[model samples]
Target: MVAMWSYSAGYNVVEVGDDVWDLIEERTLVLFNHQSTSDVPLIMAAFNSRPNLSNNIMWIMDHVFKLTNFGIVSWAHGDFFIHGGKQHREASLLELGSHLQKFYIPRKRKWLVLFPEGGFLKNRKASSQSYAKKNNLPVLENVALPRVGALKVIVDNAAAEQHTDDSDKIKYLLDVTIAYPGGRPLDLPTIFGGWRPACDTIFHYRRYNIEEIPKDEETLTKWLYDRYEEKEAILQEYYDTGIFPDAHTTHDPKFEPVETNRLTGQRVVHDTLEFILRHIFYIVSTWIWMSFLYWVFTSICQLVW
Candidate 1:
């Protein structure tokens, strides 16, 4: 469904990494920059382009998303939802950590997607800028300041889990940065209406092994901020110049792009056929219902006369 929607909307999603599959094969935590609601479909489309990456995947979503139809599906998929407000923030993170620990199993390939920015960059830019200025940090234009509390909880719990069972280790932290070339954010309505953005959607993925990250909360918090700072630099560069520099670099050599030719062709054909069949069914059903209504109306008129 994501692939069909993206392709139909004329989005050309390109993922650059050598070991994309290996990243998924490990106990992975995916951190991505959130731009718009369209980011969900775009990331799903990327996973769809690869084989088996979409399986055993879960997302950390804002609690408000759970109120939508997509939220129900996400809940069924074992995704976590958190209230981002000040009142429920701490409780939410604790609950999330508990859920992660509960669901984690040794040797199972699982990927948890997290957006540490807490909200969309555009919506939080003013506050981010103010906070950065107050703290004497550089003002970020592209990415927002990452809230580290949730990440700290997640990492601590994962580390504890690993300590209890050495086999249940977190393999890598995949830092994914998404950029829109034309600086226009894609929304659902725009995508469904086939309003293609001027440039292709690009996703840059880099992996940091768990051992490389610090165990201490303070150090880990700094590390998380540094990662977001790097993302800010990359995105700033992208906006300044219309290209992402050296986007294909990866830490692992074993990552190879899956053979997508066969899968893509089969999917395109399948989606097209399904679309046509659906329209035909809708048209026939509507015609039948309208015919029934007309017959009933005529019969009632004759009885009254």
Candidate 2:
């Protein structure tokens, strides 16, 4: 994976807005839109080169990553395991979450990446309304599926540690939506092709600020619903204006909403199923490769004896 992206004919991936970077300096939480596989790596590579940013960046890697050829790629960088599931029982995996949070936690709050969209996608967008609704329940969201495990953990942990409504600690959040100009969407092929030369692949990131958080659940729900509606409008302006998306749309409540990729049961099911299959293959391939190496080593030892 690194080889592919590293060898790309022309590296067009660039960070447009400094809102996220600026906010992080003041201790803020950022919920970014996940569009392609390159999202995390691109973010890591983008910030890794920055000498001034001190926040320790970490990402939750699924269990199957241990099996992939690129599994080590993630680990060597800032890869982490999603809380619970296959990795939860593994003591080392469970320990990593706490360890990383502390490791990355500088003198102040850390600059972390949370993929609230869960996994990379083409057109799917889950609003803040949906997230708050799910938070009302004790069960939380799907287990194996990626929702906002990292975010939930951050909130819960903060509340537990501070023994206060740490929710208030989250003074700001940037809702980053990655959109492609020229009416195109990102896909696996183009993601892989991201390593190659491409003129039409520019992705525009739109940032929105969560200006307020309701004190109660009911107000929070309404706030989230209104927030996503606001997000939809900002996306349209991106098409209308060539100027990069920023935190300018919040002041206008009357902005028109754009048609969205409606949420569906089929899309949810597909994402979960695909994530499972990817991990299964990862584990199986990892086991096979490990076994092969073990056999080769034993065979050589016996020959020498």
Candidate 3:
């Protein structure tokens, strides 16, 4: 997907945070802000250089997405396609909990990626604000108030006391904030059709040990909201100043920003290499599928004739 984006237009992805790659190797719960449908390419491009991390991660996505473009491949990779809306909400979360307990460790997944906002920012922002207004919480504009049900489900299974082996459970909380150029997000059309002046996919990452995060329902709910609040601040600052905060600016001891682009320097070799291999596989598979269809059609026509 990133390759296709790059091929269409030289889309660049920037990664910011400490120069540590340890969290990528650990059993981590990664939460991303849902901004647009085009976000996946950026995430893929970010970790594409590290195949172990990118390839081994499990995604939590909408059930309808299970029938979309890359849905079949996601099925092959064993990602959880969760149902959406209030009607299926409780059952979906229960199913998610069951899915995690059953497959998270057994399938050897290192990262569990979630968008706790439950939907895209544009779609959920109004309802999120209304809920905030009713509950006397801060009205967030940049990011939605995260639904804690999935987060609770994750922690209860992945970080709770159920696992006998400490090494097998989640050890870190990865907060990834995605930003597009000038606060303008790109969608599937923009990525596929490409754009002039190129589009930048900026990713800001912050990691905390699972021990530092709250595990209980109430505290964890507040903890999740607090993170979204921080995300709103971070995004606001970025939109206003065209740059994110550093320690001196935000007084955050955990933030040590080191930026890198995945498409530049020696990484270009890695990206191009993967691009060719991915395209080749897709092309060959598509050809084989077409051949089978052609054979079936020809046989039916012959019988009719």
Listing every candidate in turn, what is its Cα RMSD in Å to the true structure after a full C-alpha superposition? 7.0, 12.0, 3.8
lDDT of 2 at 161: 45
Best by lDDT: 3
| Candidate 1 stretches greater than 4 Å from native | 106-109, 161-167, 247-305
Q: Write the per-residue lDDT of candidate 1 for residues 99-211, one digit (tens) a residue.
A: 87676553254787889898998897899899999999878888888888877877887745446656576767878888887567787776666776534777777766666
TM-score of every prediction relative to native: 0.79, 0.53, 0.89
Candidate 2 vs 3: which has more TM-score: 3
Please write out the lDDT profile of model 2 over residues 140-174, one tens digit for every residue.
Answer: 11111134445545544432345354332444455
Q: Estimate, for each residue in 1-305, the C-alpha lDDT of model 3 and write its tens digit.
A: 46557544767766665343666778998899999977887677667767588777999998987887778878888889888788998999999988887777788789999999989899999999999999999999999999998889899888887799876799877788887777888877777787556856677777777777777899989888888888898889988998766512121344333542221212222457667788899899999999999999999999999
Error of 1 at 90 (Å): 1.2
The local lDDT score (0 to 100) that residue 218 gets in candidate 2 is: 53
User: Clashes in each model (backbone N, CA, C under 3 Å)?
Assistant: 2, 2, 0
Q: In candidate 3, how many clashes are counted?
A: 0
Q: List the residue pairs that clash in candidate 3.
A: none
Best by TM-score: 3
Model 3: lDDT to the true structure: 0.78
